[model samples]
Structure formats: C-alpha cells, structure tokens
Target: MVLPVGRSFYVTTDYGRVKGFRYAADNGRPDAPVVVVQGGISGTGQLWRLDGSGWWQSLYDAFAETEDLQVISFDYLGGLGGSTTPEQPLTVEQHALAYLQALEKLGVDRIHGWVGGSFGGVLGLQAASLKQGPPIDRLTVIGAAHKPSIQSSLLRSFQQLLLQNCDCEQQGVVLARALAMLSYRNADEFERRFEHPDDALEYLLAQGERLLQRHGKQANKLFTHLTPILNDYHIDVRQITCPVQLVSFSSDTIAPPALVSELEALLPDCDSYVSIETPFGHDGFIKNVADYQTSLSQYLPQLAETHV
Candidate 1:
C-alpha cells in the first residue's frame, strides 16, 4: 500500500540550504499544508526509517491515504543533514528562526498544523508562544519538553562524554538504545514486546548489535552536537501559548507521560492529551504510527469544531 509520498528537500537559510526531508500531498491534495520536524539531534530525518524509529512511516501511511493534505519535514543544524556552518551560537530560538525563514521563503502563510517529535516538538512549543509574529494554528507534540528533567540532563551529559572520550560507535548505540528504551517505558512494555525475560535480553542484544553496526559511529558529529542540545534543553517553555494537543506513549520512558503532565500544567491554557499505552516508549511515538492515525482521525474533527 504505497500511499502517495512526496519529495524530500531542504530550505536555504541565511547559513545556506542544507539537505532536509519532507512528506507532502498524499492522494493529490497539495493545498493542505502541514510541516513536520525531526528531533534536535544529528540523526537523519525519518521520512523513511531503516532502523529503530518507524513512527514516521505510520504517520505518513495513515495521512497519505487521505486526500487534501500536504506535509513537509527537515533536518536541523549540526545534523548529518546540515551544512558544516559554525551556525554561530545555535539555540532553540535560532532553530525556530530558521524554520520561520523557510516558511516565509516558501510563501507558506499559515499552517494547518505544526508537528514535531522530540526536539522538533520543542520548536512547536516555541511557535505556540511566538512573540515575533502570528502564532501557529495548532500544535501536535509527542515526547518533547519545555525543559529537561534531571535524568534527561544526566543522559545528555553522558552522550557528550561519549562523543568526547570513548567515541565508540558501538558504545554510543548501546547507550542510546538503553537510555532511550528506558525512558520510553517501564518494565511492562518491554515485557510485552519481548514476551519473556530471556527474550527481552535477546531482543535488546540483537537491537544493540544491529544499531552499532550502523549508526554506532556518529561520535564525530555527537561531539560537535552536545552543547546545542543542552542549550535547547534549558529553554523556558513558558513562552508557548498556542493551542496544544499532546501525545505520549505510556511506554515512553524518555519523555515520559508525566513530563507531558508538567508541560500541560505550565501551558497558559491546558489542552488535550492522548497516551498510547504501548511498550514502544519514546520511539513508540514515532514507531506506532497506525495507532496514531486512528487517534488523529477521531480527534481532529473535534479539534476543528472546538478551535474553529
């Protein structure tokens, strides 16, 4: 079921256009404008995932089947998808500015939705509280923070350390998968996914081996990456005021559903929430795309009626 998927590209910033990715116009409706953002790390945009996170695929397969929707995505600075520009003092605000400039350059006036996962979700929050111009019409953020928790900060520190000292590709993947899977859920989801204790270890071992085989060696970029992530993590989310629709995986241990509770409490206006009780945890937000389409389809009409 190859649903209509569109081109992947990048928008030139003042720094110059680096390659990014987009998914646009499934089933022949180009006018319906939506944009997607990947998280803040150096990872490639998940227009299609060969590895761990398959959530983007689920999102597209669900939306592309319907007509009248246009979606786009991109890679952020310091990323493998970005140019090697010094980017002089990159911050979340700066990142949002780049995205704004791109939207302006593309002549996109307003958006039906601004969607992001992880770091992408941070920018979405920024747009909600935008002081510069018109706020985004709607926000859909899954597993993002207005601020990093203590554990999250510690993990970021460890990632930076790995990038600097060990620089082991295998270690990086091992750390990433371990940390990421842990935050995504508690013991419940893992148990379900593995079906047995020994199976879980086997699954994790297989997962780690495969990941290290590929992306384990991104330490060069990771070393260059740490500061920016830490900076973004410290941003004050109080500025975001736009209407929000939050999604979380009960299994997601990284950006736990509890974090969403904290964010919801802080938002100028409390909004909606949907939690997918899957073992998939943080990655589940991206991987379990089918569950989301059903969620979106049911909720969107309600959102329009209420917001409109």
Candidate 2:
C-alpha cells in the first residue's frame, strides 16, 4: 500500500518551533492507534519519499501497510529537514519533551507505540520516562542503549574535534562522516565486500561525499550539534513505566549488545530483548530488517498478522 502525502504541521517546543508530519492510515479509523516513528539524528519526518530516498523506507513501508495505525514523525531541533536550528544544542530530554508537544498539538492523547532506532531510540526512552505527556503504551528501541557507550563517545568526540579544527568545514564534515561509516558497520562486512583496501576507502569517501551533496552545510551543523549530545547521553531506565522491547545487533560497537543488556536489566517493564546476528553492526537495523522483523512483529501483533 502506498502511503498518501504526509501532512506537515508546526509545534511549539521548549527551544523553539519545529516541523512534524502525520501519515494518516488508509483505513481512516478515527480511533486507530497512533504510532510515533523516528530515525537517527540526521533523520527527517519524511520516512518514505516517492523518489525512494527516505532513511527508513523499509521499516516505514512495513508500518504503513498495517491498516489499523497512524504514523507520526518529526525533525530534531538543530538537525536537518524542516525543524528549526537552535542557537544551542538541545538535550535528549528536551527533544523528548518536544516530541510530546508535537503529539499534543495533533490531539494525540495516547500513543499505541513509539518505534525508534539509533539516537531516536534514546529519545523514546527519555520520552517514556517523562511524567507529563500522553502515555506511551509500548516502546520499541533498536540499536540504542540508555546511554552512549564509552567507545562510541570517544569516536564521536574525535569527529567533533575534526569538525572544530579542520581547514575546510565541508571537508571536516566529509572526513567525519567517512570515519563514522567505519564504526557504523563491522570489519567483517568491510572485509567481505571490499577485497582491496582502496575499495574500502573509496566506499567510505563516497558515503561521506553523498551525505554532503544530499544535505550540504546542514549536515555539518547536524553532526556538530547532535554528535556531542549523543556522546553525553544517558537516561534512567527505571523511570520508564511502559512495556519496552529492545533490539540490538551482535556486532554493533556503537550500541552493542552489552549496553542494550544493561538497559534491559534496568527498564521497569521490559517486555523482551532481541539480539540479531548481523555483520552490518549498528546499521543492521536498517540494512537487515528481515533478520529481526519477525522478532519485532511479536511486539506489534497487528503488524504481524497483517504482514504475514
């Protein structure tokens, strides 16, 4: 089922006003459950574009085909897409508050589910912990932990440092993104795909160059602001009261299985923990959805029944 054009809206957040998008389900049930979907820091509310350029197209397609649900997504403050760029970076808690405000503006009293990956996952955890928003009945976090791992923090810190001191800001963005690509995927995948060292380097450079071409200077600002926030991110899992489903990749160095396990142990009502083996590492959430789609469907039974 092709999703209809998304309706854009504005919401007043603590830092400033931001843009949001709503994809009304084809079933058009007034009482249909609303599911909030989000991606990484660079991700936008446009989960799927007709041009096939969306960041979460695969997962969004799976959700969009489920006739019983509505989907909402938003851009982060100071990040790419239609959201306002804040004078200063916002915290995870602030982002979560803004997400709730966006839902409130849309008259969403309750969320059937909140599905997020990477930075979005941590945002979901922070949102579920907040006491003053509409209740989130279920939370699904993929490739993220309650806090950034020390190794991930160190890698990101270097990226920020490169951005701060490089001769050309654009080059800095390119180099940082290239460096990030290395961490996003595991060495096994790199070795398997790039038999020659030059091939691997070319692949990383191409990925970075593509990002710059796609988002321009906005990519730099996004990395500059969001990277530091992610490096320092931490959430108290005990505060979250909703049923939570955690998904992790075995080879994910950024948000490894160990870190996710820590979060699972702390969550007040963790419904399940799923760790899928994939050489793609942290990026497996997007790259190898079929590997864990069944596990994910267990949390969303409606999606399971319909998708099958």
Candidate 3:
C-alpha cells in the first residue's frame, strides 16, 4: 500500500494552537480505526513523506500497509513546526488538552490507539487520563514514563542552565543537543560505530549542527521551553483507564525499562510490556524500528475487530 499524503490543519487550544496532519487510510473504510502518533519534543506532524524524508518514515510505512487504519499527528505548542509560540511553557496536561482539542476539531470522538514515543508518550498518558474528550481504547507508549528519571532531569537542568547563561545561545543549543545525543544512545552503540574518541565527538557535534540547521532560531527557544517540562511531569497512572502497551529499550537511560515496568504495574489495564534489546538506547524507537515494529503490529490489530 502507498503512503497517503498528509493534509495539514490547525487546531485551537486554550493556551495556544498548533498545526496537525491527517493520513487517511487507503482502505477508505469510513468506520476505519483512527490512530494518533506523536514523537519526541522535536517531532512534528509530518510523519510520512513521498520523498522518504519523514522523521518516522519507517514506522509510518508499516502503518500505511495495515488495513483500515487512519493516522493523525500534530506539532506541539511552542515547537519548531507551524505552532504558536507561547510566552510561558505549557505543562503536560496543557499539551494533552491541545491534542484533545485537535482530535475534537478533526471529528475524532474516539481513538483506536494512541502511539507515542519519548515526550509524545508522556503526552499520551496525560491525554488518556483526561476525564473528558474522546476515549482512547488502547495506548502504546515507547521509551517514556509517567515522570522523568532523576538522571534525565539532571541532564536537562544542566542544558537549561547552559541555554540561560550562555552568551551565544545558538552555540548553547548546539552544545546541549550534543550532550543530549549522548543520553539518546548508549555506550555500546558508540563502541561499535566509532573506532576512536574523535570520531564519536565528530558524530555528536554533527548531530547538534544538523538540528541547529534544520530548526535554526527555533532550536534555542524550543529546547529551553519544552525540555524542562519533563521535570514538571507527574501523572496518576490509575487515571489512565485504557489498556496500555508499554515498550522500553533495554539500554535507554532516559526512560529505562525499570521506569516503564513501574508504569505497567500502575496502569489500570496493561496489555503488555515489551523491552526491546538494542544499543540505540532511548532512540531505539526510531533507530531500531525493525526490532519493535512487530510488537506494534501485533498490538494494533488486537482490537481492530472491535473498533468499527
């Protein structure tokens, strides 16, 4: 099946608004199950592209081949994408509200699944816990927990300090991103890929430079605004009534398997908890797609017969 072109739309929220995208199912079933997908803090609604440049292109490709499933995603407020820049940072609950508003605007009264990774996974938990808005039947959270880990928080706090104190803010952003790249992947990956220390340094710097080039001015503010919110996050897993599927990377220090296991135990109804073994660490969700794609495919179709 060919990937559908995404149609962009605007969603107005209480705090602000954001741009959203919808990928209609090729099966053209009006009663097709709708799935909402979200990525990390830097992620946008453009999950698939004809040129194969989408951030989640591999995952989206797998979804596109699935029968009778429509997909939607959105940019966060104050994000690099075509979203409103807020004066103050929005909390996780506020971000969830914005996502709910987007769904309502798109006439999505109920969702079959909510697939999110990293910060996006946190947003999914908050959204599913909401008392109002459409009910999500199933939730698939990858590499995220109800709260940020202590180490992850500390790292981000340092990044915030760098952004706040540095004279050259762009350089600060670059440096912060470089530091983040370290946490995103594990030592095993570095050991296998880089023959020397200089090679690893070059790779990290290049990753930071690439982000700076892609997002430009938005990079600094977006990093400063959204990065700290992870620290402020605290959710009652019992509130999320939907059956949850939790995926964690074995090497992920940011959102480790232990954190996801805790979440699984607290969730009202946990369908499954999968820990994919990969060296990619926190980035395994995107980097090691083949490893976890089967897990997602198995879970997504479990309730398909009940959706329509």
Candidate 4:
C-alpha cells in the first residue's frame, strides 16, 4: 500500500537539508492555523497508508480532517524517506531543531497542535523543551517517554550491533527490523495474530522483506541514524509550557504506560493522560486508530477554545 504524497519542499539549515510534505484544506488559506504530525521512524511524511483495497486513507486524520488548519509532516534529517543525509552525526536535539528551522522557514510562527507517535512523540517533547522552537499551543504524544528505559536502550544496542557486524548491510536491516517487531508488539498480540510459531516467523519475515524491498540500500542508513537519536532522547519537561495530552498503550514495552505517565508531573501544563488498553503494545496507537481519534477529537477542540 503506497500513500500518495505531494511534491517535496526543502528547508536548508545548519543540520543540512530537511524535506517535508504539506497537507492543507481546499481553500488554500496560507493564514490557516497549523498542525504538525510526525510519524514513527520507519514511516515517511506520508501520513496515510494504502490499504489492501488500494485506497489511501490516514490512520490518524483528525488534524487533517479539521476544516480550518494546515497539516505539516517531515522526515528526520537522515531518515528513510523524504529527507537527505546529514553532514554530521545526528542527535535528537538536532533533529528537533531541524524541524523547528524548517517550520520557521515555512513561516509557521506558532503551532496550533503538535501530534507525534513513538519516536516522533519523543521529538515533539524534545522540541517543546528546547523553549526555542515555534510556540506550541498544545502537544499530543502517543507512546512516548521523557527518557528511554534501560530495556529499550539495550534492545536498540543489540539492533545496532547486528547492523554493525553484517557483511551485507541490507541483510542487517532485515534482521534488525525483524527484531524490532518484537518490541513494537506484545506476546498477546503475537498469540492473537498467529496460529503457530511458523506463522509468526512467516509474518516477521514478510515484514522484514517488505521493509528491505521498500527502502533498499537506504534501509541501513536510516536505522543507523535513528538509533542514536533514540539513545540520546531526554527532555526537560518543565520547560514545556503548552497544554499536553499523553496517550500510552497498556501493553507497550518500548514506552510503557508507567514511564509515559511520569511526564504528567514534569510537564508544567499537562492536561490529560489517556491510557489506551490494547494488546498491540507500542503499535497500539496505529492499530487502534479509532480510539486515538476519539481522544483527539475531544481534546483538539479545547486547544482552539483556549489556545488558538
């Protein structure tokens, strides 16, 4: 399934060239309020996925669906899609600053709302903490943490090790992606999705193959660039002044609900903590889109009433 995307735009910054996509309402109102949506590391700025029926539909579209705002999304500085390679090693802080720089270039002085999933969520928090990015009226984070857990960090290290040692880099990308599937989902989901070990293996193999086939040689570089960002992500939540909404899955191993919950205290204006119960683990936010939409619909309106 391939989601259709618009022509790419570039924002050159100290980090180098950053590329992004823009989604706006039909009126083409430049003055429309803006919302930013950042996807997981594996995905590009194409917010929707092509379903099996060959239709492009966004799993998360509440922001795009809103009549009065524009939606902007971008790739990490050296990520798999859209963006180009960075001149220097990337850090989470640098990634955040890159997005801010791009937004500034785009003439977005203030963000109406910022929604990020997984690593994208971490970037959102980090950007907010910088206190130097565009003003953020509200932030919605899905399955993100202020600091990664020791377990997730170790898992990423093992992935990096696999990538570092392999003679064939694409093979390494496949293996690392397969391993990452384990962290993205929980045992219960595995049990529910597959009838047997062989079935599970087949699914993982298909996922890995799909990743390699889609990204090709760029796969390894994407993984290499993202792991460092994951390891270095730590935010000073007190610096965040915007209203925040945290949505975490009960079964997420990468960003467990407890760890995500901790952000509620540190964030000066956290408005809500929504725990979504699902066996899908870290991927629950994607797997259960309706649930997230319900929450966002209820919360985003408040942003307009109070902050817009």
Report the C-alpha lDDT of model 4 over 28-68, residue by residue, as the tens digit.
57777777888788767766533422011444345444556
lDDT of 3: 0.84
Q: Give Cα distance to truth, residue 195, candidate 1, Å.
A: 8.7
lDDT per residue (tens digit) for residues 210-268 in model 2: 99999998998778678889977678889888899999999999999999999989998
- Which segments of model 1 are wrong by more than 4 Å? 1-4, 26-31, 37-43, 46-55, 82-89, 167-185, 191-219, 226-238, 298-308
Report lDDT (CA) for all predictions.
0.60, 0.84, 0.84, 0.78
Cα lDDT of model 1 by residue, 155-241, tens digit: 666655654565665665565555444554567667566667788766665665665555445434444553336434455557666
Ten residues in sequence with the least summed lDDT for candidate 4? 49-58
lDDT of 3 by residue, 1-308 (tens): 42557888897877787898878755556556788999998888998888888868878645766656678899888887888988999888998988888787778889889999998899999999887778998899989999999989998988888778889988899889988988899999999999999999999989889999998999876676788898888898899888899999999989989888888889989998887899898999898777777777778773333233
Best of the candidates, TM-score: 2
Query: On a 0 to 1 TM-score scale, where does candidate 1 land against the true structure?
Result: 0.77
Give per-model CA RMSD.
Answer: 4.4, 1.6, 2.3, 3.4
TM-score of each: 0.77, 0.95, 0.94, 0.92
Q: Count the backbone clashes (under 3 Å) in each candidate.
A: 19, 0, 0, 0
TM-score, cand. 4 vs. native: 0.92
Candidate 1 clash figure, as a count = 19
Instruction: For model 4, name the residue pairs that clash.
Output: none
Better of 2 and 4 by TM-score: 2
Cα deviation of 133, candidate 2, in Å: 1.2
